[model samples]
Target: MKVKLYMATKSAKQQASIIGLLFAIVCFMSCQRSSNNLGVTENMEKDKTDVAEKIVLTDEEWKRRLTPEQYRILRQKGTERAFTNEMKHLGKGSFVCAGCESELFVSDTKYDSGCGWPSFYDTVDKNNITQELDSSFSMKRIEVLCSRCGGHLGHIFNDGPQPTGLRYCINGGAIKFQKDDEDNK
Candidate 1:
């Protein structure tokens, strides 16, 4: 039907009822949408979830937040030379996000595959990385990225040396060395 708002005086209980009714009406109206709008929304959401990376940044901002090596590896997806990662020391600690400083790999997940890059048996959680099909090379492969900022981290392979058959061969320059502070005690 129709809704009307009046400035006329009314009892407190009536006024409260009117307010509640208006709220319900607003909620109902907001739920209505055209089919075309729904289709467009579905497409938009699909595109967003597919490859909407939040790693976009100004050149200056990127430079300030990362070292030259880190910037090159993360933004460019360039791999560091074999045997150059500081994590090679095998220190115990959280392997945090190189871009946003969020923890993506814990010390327990870290494992050595002897392929040169620091590999992980598992990520901190599924929210930690985005996996996508990569065919840039002649071969098809899976490229792994930071889920939070979408920074290029590395690749995951089914072949791994461990109890877990999966290996997350992350880019060395894409991670930072944060030794566990508790080790000092």
Candidate 2:
């Protein structure tokens, strides 16, 4: 997914300052990817800024935009019931971050696990996720974070549905889907 950074400015200094702030925010939010096949991290070059960034939503703003169930599950670390998430049958599109609407996963990476969740073989980037130890349902699991806004997206499992052997069990409320246009492809 693309990182969107909103910049409102009245002058060059203000624009530079905003850009700097955005840089710092992105740098802090971004995680470093290890060559050892670990997971994403929060480290990168000091000045590799690109132009794909769009405006990011504030916490309060997102809360207002999303339903209580969505906010609770995606932003507040809550979980939805199994076999109930709406993204299960989702196909042929890009899944953007619900909090910011950045394209996170393409349809090609999607796979079915019959585990009542949307699974992916890989992410748009290795540093696209943050790892956490989740012990909520009296069981331990690895929690996935959006890395950009530190939003809880879902979990990762080793026993995935297919060839990649990695299941990225994402929360339905955590993302927004943009179906790919065949003509565009």
Candidate 3:
């Protein structure tokens, strides 16, 4: 009787351990799936509204309006090589969307993040840009886009200087720098 009781108790404990592990795994997977689904749904809704308000261009029109490099980054959501873009060193200029030429970032908000991209603490206006949750490359990021044309600009991060503590890390190929008149003096 004693031997049987001991064996039964051990078996119950093992079953409990297995149940706990399985529960944990299920919870983790559920949370991941929910979050990913939420991001997709939210972006879809936002994009629908944004598309209604902005210029809707066909692929041929976009290809004609943008240069090859600009089209890659803006229309195709491609990233430019780090440290190879001239916009990173631009001074006293306003950066406009390469797709629609809408004003996006000002020189005053630009900062050197040393991340081989044009970093900004702020934008020309909140209405000029849209952010969507991007889960590409097996990582999650907030993707910035031009509000006027829905062009992919880059990603925004939280690690940045004071005031906003937000970094708008933009691809140079996605924007055009127009020097401020004062800078020419």
Candidate 4:
């Protein structure tokens, strides 16, 4: 009976060790994939400046220019609560970068993705935005930034409506709406 109990305990310990090893291996592989997709070996510095016509400001200047929440999302890459963003329901206007006021998405391109964020099928100009591979939270995503100010806008995904087949899931806090005057009249 004593021998059986000892063997059982040993088997449990071995199983736990195996599970732990498998978890570690999974984590390692995930990280490896993320790293590979992050374009670490590429000339990221050169690529960053491809959209070089952008606004540059000091931290203090940005803080002064933006509200606390705006600074958090635009500068710190933070996301606002879905369905809570005021800009999600905006109509008939252009969405401009909160950091640099660069025209990003037009109203026609905006669509209800039902993903709790303001989704756009396209931007006003490709040069108005920049994309980088984000590997945060163990997820590989394409991060979109304001080319003018390099502020974090949000992520872009391939699953979107036709014409572009790209969904620009933008942070509402990262943009400000400019309504057409005719609509207001």
CA lDDT of 77 in candidate 1? 79
Clashing pairs in 2: 1-103, 3-53, 4-53, 4-54, 5-54, 30-42, 31-41, 31-42, 32-41, 32-42
Show model 1 residue runs off by greater than 4 Å.
1-56, 161-163
Candidate 3 lands at a TM-score of 0.71
Which regions of candidate 4 fall more than 4 Å away from where they truly are? 1-52
lDDT of 4 by residue, 1-185 (tens): 99999999999999999998986666334323323334322323323444447678899999999999999999999977666787655669899998888899999999987666788999998768788878787677778888878899988776678997777888889999999888898
Q: If ranked by TM-score, best first, what sequence of candidates would result? A: 4, 3, 1, 2
Top lDDT hit: 4
The Cα RMSD in angstroms, rounded to one decimal, for candidate 4 relative to the true structure is 8.9
Model 1's alpha-carbon lDDT is 0.67
Q: Whole-model lDDT, candidate 3?
A: 0.78
TM-score of each: 0.66, 0.63, 0.71, 0.72
**Which consecutive 10 residues in model 3 have the weakest lDDT in total?**
32-41
Q: Candidate 3: misplaced stretches above 4 Å?
A: 1-53
Could you tell me the lDDT of residue 12 within candidate 3? 100
Q: Decide which is better by TM-score, 2 or 4.
A: 4
* 126-163: candidate 3 lDDT, tens digit per residue: 77888888887575667889888889998777666878
Over 95-185, each residue of candidate 1 has an lDDT whose tens digit, in order, gives 8778867577887888777667778878776666777665554445567777767678877776654565667778778877677888656
**Tens digit of lDDT per residue, candidate 2, span 1-185?**
12223233346668789998986554322211111233322332222223344345777897898788878977788766555667755557788778767566877888766655677877776555667766664555667777666678887766554566667778778888887687356
- lDDT order of candidates, top first: 4, 3, 1, 2
